[model samples]
Target: MIEAISTETTKFRHATVGRTGTALLGIGIALLAAVMPLAAQSGDPRMLDKLGEAGERSWDGLLSGAAQITGAGGLLGFGVVLGWMFGREFVDGTITGLFGLPVSRAQIAAAKLIVYLAWAVLVSALIVGALIVGGLALGLGLPPTDTAGGLARQFALGVMTALVALPVAWVATVGRSVLIGVVGAIGLVIAAQVATIGGAGGWFTVAAPALWALSEGDDVSGLQLALLAPLLILVVGVTLHAWRTLQLNR
Candidate 1:
């Protein structure tokens, strides 16, 4: 079982980790790191006005700026990557090859989920690290305690947001197209927006984490946090069942 999973994971990495994708992800992070702090300190009314501060550089300000990038990036990136990863199999007509392997379809699907989750976590870490380093270099006058707590919250938010996107795998598989998954991802973002605007975002599993990340107070309850786990489990279960019973001919 371990060997089969390892082999499948390697194959997944090769198919997804292309030069263009790597370069783009790196460049996005670099730009976010460099641009966020500078924009905060730029003294432009347009920039400072949104930050709600008049030339006050602090960790909270920097993180608030960075959150805009991470929040949107984390949500969108998960959908695109998952959709592409699973959808590519159908696009290339290789999904049929997944049958009759030593590994079960469930295991292969599980391995893909695991790998993508790891990748999301790593990317989130890199984004946070860059933000921290950039904030310090810019001499944002924030205490270490506040900086640590804020970064930790941001990291958790990123992970939770990505996890909620796991159901896109099932969407891609069932629809047998990557485009469907991407569209579904966009739909989710729209739904989250609607929920937030309606003042019920905390009850929404998809929007809760991002909202919590940007919140300065205890807007999200423990029940809301706990709800995320079951949502993830439901999606994983549905996706595994879809893969296990999927008919290649259809």
Candidate 2:
């Protein structure tokens, strides 16, 4: 298993798609975070409704909006990476080569998933670091009393958001297509938005992390957050099964 993980980690280091996606994710969030404050200060009517600020235009609202990016934009970015990692083997006609390896196919798949999750953590940190730099560039003044907690929530939210994307691994492996998994990830995001609007965001694991990050409105419970464990386990199990039982004919 360690060898399998090491091999997957090596492949990840050189994966072009993964690197591009991570770059885009970081740039997109930084731009969005920077713009939020500028737009509000510029009197953009769209920023008039900055939540929790009630109309005063404060740093909390500015920072919170940036943090929420992890929940939404991060989801799609994570999906793209997951799609490429799991689906690339079949797409590159390299799945057949796995048969010669001493490690079980399932072990290889598990290793890939593990490596991806570890990558997710690093991606989340980069995102949060970018946010801080953006905030500093804008001279947001001294950090607010709650700034540290808010950033912490955003960091954890970034990771949890990526975790919720695990099902895309299952989709990619089963469909043997990176595009399919990416579509699945998009569908999941859309569904999360709708569920949040419908007031079920707290109970919906997909929407819970975002709401938690903002720390305002959409109450999430300990029980609801706890549900992520089983969902992830199921996704990982199904994805491993798909890899183990892969059919060359398909």
Candidate 3:
């Protein structure tokens, strides 16, 4: 396990598996969070009204826009990372090398997942931290006391969004192409949008976390969040199986 983990970590350091894309994603989210409030507060009442934020407080608008961007962008960003993590080996024509490693394929896959879990947590924190810094830079003033809970939910939303991207790894591994995994990620996003529009967002795992975050814990039930556990376990289990019994022909 240690060896596998080390090897995967090394690959991340030197490989070209969507790091540029991830960097651009982070920048995009940060920039959007930074500018969205300014746009909302455009100083023209007519413009603010057109944005549907007329008469809203600046801080509230900033926080709300930041949260919305985080919920949506975080999913696609994490998907890019996860898709590359699991499928890069094949894309780079290096998967065959992994077959001969002393470490088991399952261990290698598990190591990738473990690394992703840690990365997800770190990325989630960074997203919130970036927003706070952005808010302060804009002189939005001290956030309201109620803002703490909303921020916490946003942070949780980031991690949950990453977890929701896990199945992209499975899709990548099964399909043996990073493009396939990314397409799967886009599919999930579309499905979530449709599910949310249909009012089943609470019951749908992919849609629930974002909805909960956006609603500030008012909409989605605890049962919906808990349901994510089994789905994740199933995904990871099948992913490991795919690696453990991997064959070249497929």
Candidate 4:
């Protein structure tokens, strides 16, 4: 079990949080930070006009703007990473070698989740740091208390987004392809948009975090937040089961 755990951990670190992934994450943060000041203006002129009264260049505004960018990226990243982690084993035929290992497949799956969670947290922190630095550089006049609160909220939102994306692992495993998992992730984004546009976003687990991050108001209820627990539990359980009983016959 220890061997399996250590091996999976090392693989995840190399694939997801290694130099290349870290560099990409840094570049994404920098791009988001640079565009935050111009977010309201860089898009459609009509949209900017519509946001005229609400879109001041305040700290909260900047956070929301950055969240809008990072939230989508985070979700996409989660899906892509999970897909790669699981699907690559199948593609390379390494999955067949796990049949009689002393370490169970479930443990390997769990290790992947742990590693991905750690990566997600680190990327989220870097994003928040970049936003703070960028806001300060732009003289956005961020009040300390509000800035602290916003940071906490953003951090929580980022973590929750990663948790919510756990099901993509199962999707990748079942489909045996990363492209399918990416498509699943895209489907999720579309569903979130539809739910949000229909005014039921607060009740939807996937949409709730993004909505919360984009708005300063209390858009989500306690019940809504609580629902995410069961969703995560369900996906994790299903994934472990799938990995344990999987028959890799190529």
lDDT pick, better of 1 and 3: 3
In Å, residue 151's CA in model 3 sits off its true spot by 1.7
Query: Which runs in model 1 stand beyond 4 Å of their true positions?
Result: 15-30, 40-44, 51-56, 141-143
Q: Residue 242's C-alpha lDDT in candidate 4?
A: 92
Q: Among these predicted structures, which one has the highest lDDT? A: 2
Kindly list the per-residue Cα lDDT of model 1 for residues 187-212, writing each as its tens digit: 77878889988999899988888778
TM-score of each: 0.87, 0.92, 0.90, 0.88
| Candidate 4 ranges beyond 4 A from true positions | 16-30, 39-44, 50-55, 141-143
Ranking by TM-score, best first? 2, 3, 4, 1
Tens digit of per-residue lDDT, candidate 3, span 1-250: 9888887778775766545644544455655767765676568777666555312446556556655766667777788778889888898899999888888899999999988887777766776677677678877776678778766876788788889889999999998998998888888888888998999999999889988876777899999999899999999999999999999876
- Note each model's CA RMSD in angstroms: 2.7, 2.2, 2.4, 2.6
What tens digits encode model 4's per-residue C-alpha lDDT throughout 159-222? 8877887778999899888777778777777787899899999898988887777775478777
Give candidate 4's whole-model lDDT: 0.74
Clashing pairs in 3: none
Regarding lDDT, does 1 or 4 come out ahead? 4
| Model 2 Cα shift for residue 40 (angstroms) | 2.5
